[model samples]
Target: MEIALVGAGAAAVGLLDALATTSLARVRPGLITVFEPSPHLWRGRPYGPDLDTVLVNAPPAIMSIRHGDPGHYAAWLGESGAAHLDDLLGQPLVPRHRYGDYLAATAEAALRTLRANGWRTRIARARVTGVERRGDRLAVVAADGGRYAADQVALCVGGGEPRDLYSLAAAPGYVHEPYPLARTLAPIPADARVAVLGSGLTAVDVVVSLAARGHTGPITMLSRSGLLPHVWQRPSGHRPAHVTAERVATAHREHGTVPLGHLIGLLRAELAEAGEDFDAFAADLLAAGTEDPVRRLRRQLRSVGDPRIGRRVLQETAHTVGPYAWRLLPESGRARLRRHFRLATSVASPMVPVNAATLLRLLDAGRLTLVPDVRAVEATGGGFAVTAGDSAIHVDAVVNAVNPPPQAVPRAAGELVASLVSGGLAAFHPAGGVVPADPRVQVAGDLAGGGPFITSGIPGIAAQAARTADAMLTLARDESSEAPATLR
Candidate 1:
């Protein structure tokens, strides 16, 4: 049997670790090749060493490389002596590069195991260009004119092209990409006025990175609502009164999908049960028209007393129902959720306290300007002029701090995803992702051109990895029994 995993991001790491250990001895694939476009395995853009202080959003325990060993990553940190950093804060968020190193080490361990079992394994440092089905086997083509035959192909390609606010392709000093911040912004003058175009997690990364690089000039973070993400407190062991798994299941059974109305009602019920008013809690978290919305939220949570419980209460509730809601909801329902996702994210996806604190420090020092209601950013002869509402500010440089571009898209999913869709091997679904691709070819992570329903957080991603491993094992076992003697 031959199994192929495409792309070497977090999803690829999870799949590779699982597939390496679970194959039955008889059914162990003769060859397992990983096609990774990046220079190294495991460290994708997010976890790559783009910035010095860009710490991981999740801690070690939750950011496990493999699903079965949930504590493996945290343990690896302790054994590697990297845990010393956590001494400052009892439970510390790891540096992004540290997580990348962990991934590389995990990949090394997995390769050793597969080699010991006499399973031929190789990492092809090239992007998979195409996947074409021929007879019972599949042909995996790489960009560098190499082809490998695999009984199964798993597309773990990450997201597609980024969602951009403006088309700055022709503008000088207009940077639409955010990674390799150390390199991208290296040419800017120290006192150059800079403008960043977003205010989410990625924006925090830009601000932190600039500060670390000793960029002393004023940096403006421009956005609508002008609200920074709230900071995360240590999570509490609290369960919701109304937004339980049982309730989600009930909603699915009764409504065919988790109705948007029912989901909202469940949230309101949870607030009422806790003697909290839903409107008040939301107002405090989504407090816009203020210079420091994030600080206001932190203060509000503290005022509630037992801040951890108060902060995590709504986040936990939304996450609990999210998977069910995404899978079961129709187009209209998903649309409804998307409309409020940013607001939901303000509470559901808070920045790590460290990043938030850094932002506050920068703000207090008057080094960072938070611009509200960004209308347009047009290229000027000298630089880019940003128009926010009726006001305008020209900056020498513009750094797009929006979400990173998706790794693949349907139309421009390069050769691999395009081949799969064009050859009828897969079909795209905004909510459902690619329709299972093929029964034999399991597509992990996001499959659609844009937003996918797959859970991307650590716990959910690890769980999905485990499931993919089991599926690979079952498929390998069945295929080995029927494969020709040459394949075996």
Candidate 2:
């Protein structure tokens, strides 16, 4: 049997690791091919060392390739003895490069194990242009006119491409992509006025990078809300105990509405009753829930009246949900929750003080300027014209911090995603993200009802890979008695 995996990001790495560690002596594939444009397969954009300011939003302990091993990443850090881990875990913030190194190391270890297991591994250093079903097999065409046939294909492409700004693109002093931040901003003068389009995590990274590089210029960040990511806070020991299925059902039974907030209060009360560590409890709940608890709470709120009950349900869901889901809460919900919770919440970075302090220091020293808005950009005689609301400002260069549209896959990894969608092999999820065959892994990074999956984050992606490998192995065992269907 032969297997092909595309886009060697976190998901692909996890899959490879699973294949290497599993008891595959009886059902191992004859060959495994990994398609990636990068020199290295596992170290995609997120783990690449190109940008120093791109920190992992999650803590090291929760960021590992293994499932049910919360401390795997932290343990690896200790064994590697990387000096930065101490500072990273010590302070509220950790450098992004360190995390990249961790991923690289993890990939290397997996590769070594695979080689020892006698599995033939091939890393194709080229772009995969398209994939098509050919009889019972899959055909992967490369940009350089090469092709590979596999029994199955798994697409683990990363995020989509950066968006293009018409005004910014035509302008003489505009920076389009922010990934290669140094190269994009290299031509700008040290003291230049700049405006960032978005105020999310990417925007913050750009700002932090500029400061580190000693770019003493007026910098203005613009967005719909102009809200930055919240900072990470010290773990609070406030576990809630009322998260049992029985309690949840009872609450639903008694009151027509499960006020999310009230549910949270009950959970907190239950945690206090159980006497479990708050941090551990919170992590466990987040790791378990597949759906967005907040959204569920909201739906329950609308279905049932009783203002008090509604508040309780919302609170409970909010306390138990993961950061990614919590971040999806409506802006109003976020604001209300912030006022009630004193503990470290993931709505935004809890370490905003550090980020705010850095930005304020730059502004007070005339190193940055606050711009009203980015009105328009046009080519000027020598440089570019930047309009801020009503006023026009001239600058030698401008960096676009606005996030690109969800399409236009970025890097080599996203090509397979585009192919899958265009081929009708996958469909988009109503609520952001591509659906995969398995919820744990995404197949072609598109939301379609099929197996061989891909996921958004490391934890989920890792889980998906392991699950896929297990499924494939099971199929391999069954193949001895039954003929498996091939791509028609």
Best by lDDT: 1
- Per-residue accuracy of model 1 over 1-488 as CA lDDT, tens digit each: 78888877777777777867675666754788888767757776667776657778754555786875757887877755444343322355777877889888888788788778878888888777888888978898877788889887887776654456688877889877777777788888889999988888878888888888898999999988786766665644456777766888887888777767776687778777777777776576545445366467446334332533555666554433465456666778778766765666666656766666677788878998889889999888899899999999999999887764322453334567667778777776654456556766777665532332323555545556666778878877777777788977
**Which whole-number lDDT from 0 to 100 does residue 63 have in model 1?**
71
lDDT of each: 0.70, 0.56
Each model's TM-score? 0.86, 0.70
User: Candidate 2, after superposition: displacement of residue 339 in Å?
Assistant: 19
* Model 2 misplaced stretches (Cα beyond 4 Å): 22-26, 51-54, 79-82, 85-94, 236-357, 363-366, 369-395, 404-408, 411-424, 428-433, 436-455, 480-488
| Sequence-dependent TM-score of model 1 | 0.86
Pairs clashing within candidate 1: 159-406, 159-407, 159-408, 160-406, 160-408, 162-405
